[model samples]
Target: MTAFDGIGGAYAENLPVIMISGSPNTNDAGAFHLLHHTLGTHDFKYQIEMARKVTCAAVAIDRASDAPRLIDHAIRSALLASKPAYIEIPTNLAAAPCAPPGPISAVLAPERSDPDSLAAAIDVAVSFLGKKLKPMLLAGSKLRAAKAEKAFLELAEATGYAVAVMPGSKSFFPEQHPQYIGVYWGDVSTKAANNLVDWSDGLLCAGTVFTDYSTVGWTADPKGARIFTADMDHISVTGHDFSRVLLADFLSGLAQKIKYNDATMVEYSRFRPNPTLQPAAEPEAALRRGEVARQVQSTLTPNSTLFVETGDSWFNGVQMDLPDGARFEIEMQWGHIGWSVPSCFGYAVGAPNRKTIVMVGDGSFQVTVQEVSQMVRLHLPILIILMNNHGYTIEVEIHDGAYNNIKNWDYAALIETFNAGEGHGKGYRANNGRELADAIAKAAANTRGPTLIECTLDRDDCSKELMSWGHWVGAANARPAAAI
Candidate 1:
């Protein structure tokens, strides 16, 4: 089912989402006729069986009386695991008479780490830090799910170590912070980030994840430094593994136990220069990816939330210089291409106080372009930077073929077609730097509805990093049979 990818995304990203579905009633057993959407088979449990693979918890509510308890269990499991849950209610059971729901009293938070494990993890981490002359911190994306970002920042401040956030964890720590270095992605690391991380004798890689894409085709090297990992549900330092030690608790405890160590920062300052992202571009020159990044960075405000589609947009977004309060949303794990349109719309609905700026490529935009109409109908103030590249550039970089090309659309005019001139949503096409600046200014002033700016670019125009990354990924995928 289409919902399967979303559920998988939630699981991989560690979001607590609950999905409810309707099924044939218990009395309709073997009738396949009872439900039109049933897989048209006698196996009634097939749906839940498939869902169980991607969800943290899956439950079937066979009776009206059991709904409350079953639902509570599902919710609690999903919350504790920071993953998705599925609840299926039969048709007859759903229609059955039940007592009216009561207002929820305060819900309880998940349990803290095991006391023994927590104490041991902190002691080991403290001991490890005491032995090292030069140590550094590496932040990862999993900190969001662990609710450990504040603690991670506290640890970074309490111990004056230079920090390099893994590529996937960009913006986890305030990028503008004094101690923050850059995004570390092995060979593609920013400025001196990889050097600093590799040179350290001790490393604390908190909440980090390493997949082929994140590691750039598995070329990332931690070097010979001893790694102390405060993973989601456990802490692993050297050879010791402390189970049931939550990341938040371990970080909080480590912050309390450690004092400032200026060795790493002293060395970092001796390096060439501070990291710079997306250097300034000429406003009069033809538009390029760097120019797009530069313009996007200029548009970010403290109240803005940037959404990056899963394509070259991801690499472009990495160049943004986020303000202290700016939020960056990217579905990097289970990267379904068209996820941004719907997701950006949903985020606008949830956080109306914040402005949404989404960068999506033409190939990906076509997949879920219909969601923009919902924005117009709701009068949501959002800015969509559509890159009309005429094809799947990310795919072309990986392995070019006829299927990589897409039919080009007049993307800027789509807003008028969606509204038929009824709604206030506006659209503009940007061919160069001047057009982009004008479009952005107009978008900033438009609050009645969403504004879309389509920036036309060549199909082959993409980040050089993307091309290099794709080559490695292609090689990894095309290894000889004997290598395995």
Candidate 2:
């Protein structure tokens, strides 16, 4: 028997995967009837039984005529459970005729969130909103997938709430909007953003998977604070009952139902970010890489897309100023180290016409470096900025004494290694601000394939603000009971 661990164990939380397997039919005379060592033993029910442990639902279909209904039930189970499911198809039935398409009937599941529970949650949320001087909204990816962006924006605008988007959900709400705060997660997140989470009287999560990475390991507060969550599955809250579970579809509809008033809008405007955060500094040679990233922001056309990898490069990548229609993507859920390359491949494929750029650190670049071949083969007009600091800089901050170091790579040479020749694509190296600017300009001009800019910077150069914020947050988390 073959065991399949669906993608949901760690990687895919909300995604549904259906696994189908083939088994030899017992009715066939030529099939061996061996119970222990031979093929098709134990009636093939054990495979389905084993699959049941990992899957939300499982079934075995022996007859050819029942294949359609069995497959339909498996799919329905997956959607309803919002998790992985499986089905075992007999080898003999594999070649059988499938039933004609039937009238599609929507599977109606019971209301996940009770009306009274929703009312109670709304009451608690409203009470907290009335009391708090400054409250904020932390929007997640599920909300974007459910198409609740507009409604979420309206809610934020109506309630005098500042918005802090999670890394994966960056650009869900326009980054340039006055009410928008920066991305949260990792050491790069702003101190003010973490403060907003800690001090807020109410923390409302809509369509967000409240995982450890997103909440920074529950370091943010939840107790006594009003918490209202809307998700397709039943998520346990400290004080709430199971009745608080909400269907993703219904939550979106409810968001649209609420009306916004002018007075509410005026109140929301009060929380808009102060303009002092934006600063101008001379482009120092040591800070050339980060400065170039900021400069690239200005070159972006409307609706340009940016994808950032995890590591030192992310430190500067998040600081890039974006235009109104620009979008940014980062892996906040898994925090997988080498995701930028493949993720950029996926993004470029999905949005072919849009300008896509990936920012990666030297250490992260090597993990999935081969993805450059994919970009070259497809002729994607993507730009890659390699921040070659020679090692893992973020790890150094996390554990000051530990050696989480890495060997260096001649990053620009990888373009040729991947077979992207001069006419197809070119690689450039930058050691200072002027060279970095020239490299970026050349990349912007190249419309054929991807370009890689390897920027050499001193290892000592790091984001001081980020380091300070990390220390403050860590110390706050370690404070004594009296401090709380």
Candidate 3:
């Protein structure tokens, strides 16, 4: 009950999770026997109702014979919707006999992609591109979620157009691809990358959610460009909308017909890395935010995975290169603070064989600090680089509000405190760049258990990209009311 509110968006955004809950027996209903976890009402549907808001489907398994069908329906709905589902099994039915699940492909309903819609969408996109002098592909995270990464890459290669990724979809597309440009986050984007994208004559965005965060508060000026966008179920090209078109089907069709735009690729300098601007002073001269980013970048390896918190980490992590096979996870759409802590915990468990690293801020860390104990208990060797920026620096950068200032905690001591003399984990506090580097090296070598390295930084330490994004988003959030 206490954690229900936290997963609303998680379910809505199609996060695949199964929550099996135990409830009172259906026979016990209307007996006036109050259940301990109930809402003190005769009706037992209260909890189910609460869960229905977030989950795609909720089922109560009342009969043992019907259990398999109900379970199958719940699972199918969850997969199709890409969301969470609820299944309530009474304590009495816990040992119920059910039909065995045969082949999974036969159990789930087939997802049909309309042939007409797919072909039309592809034709429209191809025609739109053929008329433009410059066309590019803006890829998003949904490409990975919808299992269309291969199709998307094929389309990019087939079209021969320059490719860019939205901030939210970072690492979904291979950054090392020859035609790959850089992240396109509007005003917060790298100057060359943003210009190439915004100035394009045609833009085909696939599996993208153009939320405020991705567009830098809707300041991206791609309206002038002919737009063709595709998601899981629908594709919109210019003004025409095609329904019942799956993202993979559309991309696959586009890949078959997308004309080569070699001229555009040549003009944009394809295969070249984004231009890097040198800082005036050496990175070690002062303990600056950019230097911190550089250190984090240097720490990444081909086998490592990075889980960045929803704040300055987004900007800093973006600047780091993701070697092939390396994964980067961030909650951009939800933008929930402290999400990366538990998220990293789950990630570590799911990918136990891979090296995991989490970059979290002091304020965000406080919200999900308890998860560290579980990581230690499970012996997950994740390196936690906690940024000690005093408070919510991202919020301060956006709106200098007093509420953004939060109470700071002794973050590094938490590992030992949670360990409780168990020696299950290690912790360290670093106040300077040298100390930070040393602590990182220690974390890299320590494989005994999870490690926490608290890096003390200036209160205002933030990336330039964050400052620009914050300003734009702040302005949008503070829109004038009723035109005054």
Candidate 4:
């Protein structure tokens, strides 16, 4: 039940996760015995039936002979949908004998688009690409789920248009790329990003998702007829649907059919990094949000993996550029606070060889702080840089009210209580820029166990971009009543 409750976001994002569980014995399933986990019912299919609502496929392995085929079907369905799949092995059949696995093949074969439909969509898209004076590429987070990241990047390289990622796709593409602009979320976008995208005569959005939060509460500019969209199951141009297409195949085909141009390269060059803009002298007294962000960026290594929490951290963390070979994860569509803490625990377990760093806010950290004990128990090298702003800073920025305030916790001290005064783990509190830098360095060097660094900041100090985004979203949330 707990797992089911947390799976909807993964399903909506089309993330692939396989869940296997042990079920009641098939013999007892229909007998007088009432299971400990199930609702009082003779039918054992209720749990699986409920799971089917969220998962792409669900199956109960009642017979040993049927396990192989059923498991294969669930895996293939999950891959095809890029969503989760559930499999249950009855306790009586837990040791079921199955044939050895077969050689690897295309489990979910690529479904080709109709030739005429594909050609027409591509022609319309190509016409827009070639004729338009300003064309832009907006990549979405689904490109990562579809395993089409490389193909999408190739497409961006081939078509020399400025590329911007959606808010949900902050780290999907390399931010420091030559043609990369910034995130494009309509009104929530940076001045340069919104301007370029709004002025674009043609837009190519691949694997894009547009929700109220991502679109500034549904106040984003509507797409015109010059937009090309490709998803996992569909490809379309100007609302003309091209069915049964795969994103990777569509990108490959489009790459071959188009003549590459670099008209937008001039605009892209204007957004390139300017070293002179960086602060010449570090603030030795007070620690600001921007300074904390810069410090986090300075500590990142090529092998480090970063998880940014949902809050003002989104705006600050997105400012950091990912180094080569580093991995980044953020939950934008779900936007659930405190998810990173536990998720980073799982990440540490999966990749023990690499260091895992988490950027979490004080309010959100309170929700999932217990996960830190698991890291300490396993001696995982997880560095938690906590932003102690005394309340839900994101909410205060969005809709300032008395309800948004929270009781402050001595976050760094709690680490000692969790650790039970053991020197196996460490905790540090930093209230100023110099102390914050020292704490970061100490945490980086301490690899024996998980270390927690609580950096205190003014409650009102948040990234300017977050404030800008919050204002727009707040206004949208409280829009004037519509006429009947």
Among all candidates shown, the one with the greatest lDDT: 1
Those runs of model 1 whose alpha carbons end farther than 4 Å from true positions after fitting are 30-34, 95-107, 223-225, 272-285, 482-484
TM-score, predicted candidate 1 vs. hidden true structure:
0.95
TM-score of each: 0.95, 0.74, 0.93, 0.90
lDDT (tens digit, per residue) of candidate 1 on 126-155: 999889999899998899998889999999
lDDT per residue (tens digit) for residues 26-110 in model 4 = 7795566887888888777878988898899999888898887888888888888889999999887888777765544545664
Taking all chains together, the TM-score of candidate 2 against the true structure is: 0.74
- Poorly placed runs, candidate 4 (over 4 Å): 40-44, 98-120, 268-284, 400-403, 418-423, 479-484
Q: Is candidate 1 or candidate 3 better by TM-score?
A: 1
Best by TM-score: 1
- Clash-forming residue pairs, model 4: none
Better of 1 and 4 by TM-score: 1
Minimal lDDT window, size 10, model 3: 277-286
Regions of candidate 2 where Cα sits further than 4 Å from its true position: 1-97, 100-136, 183-191, 194-197, 208-219, 232-287, 400-403, 420-423, 465-484
| Pairs that clash in candidate 2 | 160-268
lDDT by residue (355-465, candidate 2, tens digit) is 998888787887888888888888887899887877766655544543556787888877887763544666898876777778888988888778999988777566764
Ordered from best to worst lDDT, the candidate numbers read: 1, 3, 4, 2
For candidate 4, the lDDT comes to 0.79
Q: Which ten residues in a row have the lowest lDDT in candidate 2?
A: 2-11
Instruction: Give all candidates' CA lDDT scores.
Output: 0.86, 0.64, 0.81, 0.79
True-vs-predicted CA distance for residue 212, candidate 4, Å = 1.3
Clashes of each: 0, 1, 1, 0
| lDDT measured at residue 304 in model 4 versus the true structure, 0 to 100 | 83
